[model samples]
Target: MENLNNNEYQKFADKKVPKPTYLKNVILAFLVGGAICTIAQGVTNFLESQGYNEDLCGMGTSIVMIFIGSLLTGLGVYDKIGKVGGAGAAVPITGFANSIVAPAMEFKREGFIFGVAAKMFIIAGPVLVYGIGSSIIAGLLSILFKG
Candidate 1:
């Protein structure tokens, strides 16, 4: 190590780092994300076929998907899926569910109030706040602009 100059050390470090396989990651993300959406769509279609209205079908499907996401997270399967699917597993509503539940599960040893309840919103809290704030602002703007 002492014999190496700065440039030589830098070159050695660069070579030692593994390169990312962008194409394979992209394909995996696409397939995993597509499969998740397909499952949601299937649920929606089934609800619709049973003569439910559009709103009900959409709501039911969301509830089902969130439950599935939470269940998978609890079972420790979602993390593996996340490793394989990358952003594909994370871009869906299920990911939002995972974000809430994962932290709670991790912190549960501290007790329910300080651990699970408090930490449950660690990730999703900011998202929820921003989403609600934006919607409120948009609603106000729409009301003010109404002719």
Candidate 2:
């Protein structure tokens, strides 16, 4: 009985196999990243074709993508995409928006003030703060250089 148990344990231990090739992972990452960029390019082209200014077109595209991401987050689809696409979906501006919206949605049950309103800017606050700070610093530098 002892020998039989040891054999059984050995068989179970031997059944554990190593994972597949690194090339497969690389290919999948490449495909997902390409798909994300393709989608962004398509949206940008569509926006430009609609006669929007370059800045407006860019902003519109970002807004639309973020909104779509947020919606997907609400519908629990964004997480699925993240799982499949990994860094592909998580590296974009849309992902930033999703990050902001996700926490707010999750905390929505706590009450509007503490939950929705407060959490809405949790992810975006630092970006906004740094954006303004950097702009101000750049403007000061420009003025100093010009003067």
Candidate 3:
């Protein structure tokens, strides 16, 4: 009877939950990333095919993507996509825009000062800092090289 109880305890304690494989996650990430890039490329191609200049096509593609992201965000759809796509959604510029807007939306209820205005840039602060810092460093290096 003691051995039976011991066996039952062991069985309960030794139960294991299976986890998704790393390779499966990696493959899903890759596919989602590729799909996003492909959509961006298609937008560019469509713009060019419609007689837009290359620069305009590029800008339009960016604008369209950001608009789509913002719209999805406003409609609460982008959050769902973000949850599923993870790094795939995050690595794109649209994701950067979403990051900025989403936080602002969330904090909007706390009043404009501490909530909307303050949090508007919260997600983008690091990105802006790094971007400006890199540009300054690059400009300084260019000036030094010229001298």
Candidate 4:
């Protein structure tokens, strides 16, 4: 094992590593992402048909999608979807819900306050912080440039 030099060892290791299926992964991600968007659009359409105002329809659609994501995560289905869909499943609002719920579920053995609540935001905290921060910065810039 110690006989080979760095260059030889690197070449051996590179050959041993499996190559990724880039085209297949891309197709799966595109299909899964499109499916998620289709479901969300269906929800929005249904809400709109029920006489919901545009704002309410948007809010309701978000709520339903989040609930579906959290439910799927709890039921152990979302993880499978994530494995297959890769970033496709992780880029939507449903994926955001999964991120929030997944850590909480994993740490629930520690108790509600320290486990569930504390770990709940572990994944989504940075996202929320940066998202809100960026929005605030953008708003300020917009106002400044409004002259």
lDDT of all the models against the reference?
Answer: 0.94, 0.81, 0.85, 0.96
Clash number for candidate 2 = 0
Q: Decide which is better by TM-score, 2 or 3.
A: 3
Q: List the residue pairs that clash in candidate 4.
A: none
**Steric clash count of candidate 3:** 0
Q: lDDT ranking from best to worst?
A: 4, 1, 3, 2
lDDT of 4: 0.96
Task: List the candidates ranked by TM-score, beginning with the highest.
Answer: 4, 1, 3, 2
lDDT string, candidate 3, 1-147, tens digits: 655788777777677646556786677668767787889999999999999999999999999888888888888988787777777887787788789889989999999999989989888899999999999999999999997
Q: What 10-residue stretch in candidate 3 is worst by lDDT?
A: 13-22
Candidate 1 residue lDDT tens string, 16-68? 99998899999999999899999999999999999999999999999999999
Evaluation by lDDT, superior candidate among 2 and 4: 4
Supply candidate 4's per-residue lDDT for 16: 96
The model with the greater TM-score, 1 or 2, is: 1
Provide the TM-score for each candidate, comma-separated: 0.85, 0.69, 0.77, 0.90
lDDT digits (tens) for residues 37-124 of candidate 2: 6787889999999888899878887888888888888898887877776666677776777778888998899999999988888877
Q: Count clashes in each candidate, considering only residues at least 3 apart in sequence or on different chains.
A: 0, 0, 0, 0
> By lDDT, who's the top model here?
4
Local error of candidate 2 at residue 41 (angstroms): 1.5
Q: Which pairs of residues clash in candidate 2, taking residues 3 or more apart in a chain or in different chains?
A: none
